[model samples]
Target: MSISRFAALALLALPLAACQPNVPQESMTDPQDATEADIARWYIGTIPDDPFDIPQVDTNLLPEEMVRQTVKYNGSEQAGTIVVDIDSRHLYLVQNNGTAVRYGIGVGKQGFSWKGAARVGRKGVWPNWSPTSTMVRIKPDLPRHVKGGLDNPLGARALYLYNGNVDTLFRIHGTNEPWSIGQAVSSGCIRMLNQDVLDLYQRVEVGAPVIVKRTGKRVVANAE
Candidate 1:
């Protein structure tokens, strides 16, 4: 149906699945609706970055045809099993059943795609950026650290990926450059729209299971 109807249905469905095993949902209190600032701060402890400071756009921006379409969430869409389908360039937050809140995503370049399971170990809003040594070496003009704002590549939200207790340094975050949604430009992180990432950041919380697959992940229907 409509986005609101879909959201309401998903909200109704959540409580009924309480007995199932997966990530536990955090009790929401601060404004039920996920806000861009809430998500941004949740990740980096601040509001979003300014736009004028962004670096030159990457030349590897994605062409629509390159974005695949078959990425699907195959498990409990409950707070667990956040799947990013690289081949399809879509990120799915599976709650349950045959439904998932799917959003288009941007992924890594040729040798940059990574596959593994992780958790949203941490979060941020309007996050700051620091060029990895690799990015600095590759783009001599890149800054060592950037102040958060519109131009900041970190965008609206940041879901820090982790596995067990270790940080993977990869994040499913927002991009101010919305056109990059279906492209491959970053080192190995997944990117989403500022709105989409804000929406996702509100839906997800710490201790959630995140699966990133370059090809795809198999889903077990009704796993919740």
Candidate 2:
């Protein structure tokens, strides 16, 4: 998003925050007091004065950094520096000839597994979760739309997919169900640990191509 949008969100939220009773006086600022840096952070909901340092985890909650030593292979290692082996459920970031830094991944369940090449068309931090019309049709009571937060099924980052110029609505993103790693479990989205997604976000630029080769294709999507 543009810096203006970030500034607008910050300006919007800070006022709501300052309006709450018991907030310190110094925290309050004039309309002119908003700064570019403040806007960037609060827009991202990553305020400097956040209270929590070490995060707390619940049993039902998946730790964002969970790592599994599972096998994974995909032409991702060849996808202009990244490859995701869906069968083995691993994501690879190429560093050199025939070598890459790999991370275990979670995948779509059985019928939901997708195969084909696409590009990272969009990226979002702390993305919101809005079940598709199909998702709601499958389960009527499911929340139609939800904002971003720890409770969101999508974790800290998201990489939206596209076929040429057409949006697929599928994404490579963080998941709350880390236990689903190495398994097909999503409606169609590719999932990874939050730490892994964050790692990828830093490494991949928008428009990077992702080759999601079919299962059992020795050319890509290897279990090892």
Candidate 3:
């Protein structure tokens, strides 16, 4: 080929190369060697201003998909609605901008799972816990009243769900067991990471609608 022809081909290839996606650089540093400060850099960092000291989460324990992030939402639900997909183990807080803040969640196991709509009747910070009569019957040793703290089953925040004027006796709350964030092990309540629950608690308001669906459609992650 002539030199002029070769130059034209090279220019064509340059545009194609520029259009290629830029891949993120992989870290060579070992996660096991990560320091406390390094771990604190996680999106879900320790919350210092909280009434009780919230510790930084060790992200290694959580699956990458379980990490909180904003994702594309295709549902018709209005902004401020909470949609929990029990099958996908995901909770989406709908936004007005065609996106939703997604969080990993733990749902009830087996016979404990239920599906329906409810409203956030109340919000609590470091709330006290009282086992239901049914809960007491199942676990007779369970304390009727437990003061709220780090040791409490409801970690840092709780959003009490209500059906009309009646309390559903179920909740979406932070869990003392962070590792259970993506599992199906809770008795009936939806469990979230303490940091995530704190974030959710702030964005949501009393009387916000919540839909819990067993086989709901999963939200697709935004490619951009």
Candidate 4:
């Protein structure tokens, strides 16, 4: 190898490195052993610290594990894939690197639970809430339509799921009930804290792949 060739290779590598998103690794901390400062720094790194937003999540209402954290993902899914583990009540957005941004999520109750592969068919920021006919029939008091905003059951964001061209009538959305996170509380939708959902909405685009699993499925690279 010549010095000139090595120098040329180094120069080429510099531009490639610069093109990558600057995802900080130092702030990554284990949720179990993290300090208050560690949690604060990690949270700030994962999402914007917007205190005055109308739909901001109440950190006081969130459990520690529910706070967004970037973790080592041993999964096979490529970057931008969204994996929802129903049993764990966590949604992971696979990153370009070998890691994932995990958010605490709320899944549907027993009979309402489902598992399948779908795509993010649509995205809504403070999207409107419309009770499905089935929901309206089951709960006569439910509203048919509600405008989007802080008070809406959809909260800050919603990602509508679709299997090819068919609407699944399911969503990965923000919830007004933050306390319901990490629980099986939704009629069918997968819910997140408002802030987390907003962050996720920003990262994902329409047509992104989504996998909802009932069991803890291992996503190995070769098998993916």
Which residue pairs clash within candidate 2?
Answer: 73-85, 74-85, 76-82, 76-83, 76-84, 77-83, 108-184, 108-185, 109-184, 109-185
lDDT of 2: 0.58
lDDT of 3: 0.74
Q: What does candidate 4's lDDT look like per residue over 15-114, in tens digits? A: 2443334343332212334333322321211133333143333353455666788888888888999998888778999998788999988888878988
Q: Candidates' lDDT values, in order? A: 0.60, 0.58, 0.74, 0.70
TM-scores, each model vs. reference = 0.63, 0.64, 0.76, 0.71
| Number of backbone-clashing residue pairs for each candidate, in the order shown | 21, 10, 0, 1
The Cα error of candidate 4 at residue 155, in Å, is 0.9
Name the runs in model 3 displaced over 4 angstroms.
Answer: 1-45, 216-224
| Candidate 4: segments with Cα more than 4 A from true spot | 1-52, 216-224
Per-residue accuracy of model 2 over 1-224 as CA lDDT, tens digit each: 33234334444544343333331122312224544433322221222211211111121222222243333333334534556666766666655444556666777776777878788898988888899888888889887776765456677789988898898988888754444655666787888766567768878898887766447432333434
Query: Candidates ranked by lDDT, best first?
Result: 3, 4, 1, 2
TM-score of 1: 0.63
Model 3: per-residue Cα lDDT over 122-152, one tens digit each: 9999888999888899989887787887667
**Which digits, one per residue and each the tens of the lDDT, describe model 1 over residues 1-224?**
32233233333433343333332223322233544322222221123334322222222233433232333344644644688778767787776555677777778877878988888899986788887777778879876777665556686578989888898878888765444566576678998766567768888878888887665432322212
lDDT: which candidate is best? 3
**If both were scored by lDDT, which would come out higher, candidate 2 or candidate 3?**
3
RMSD of each: 15.5, 13.0, 16.5, 15.9
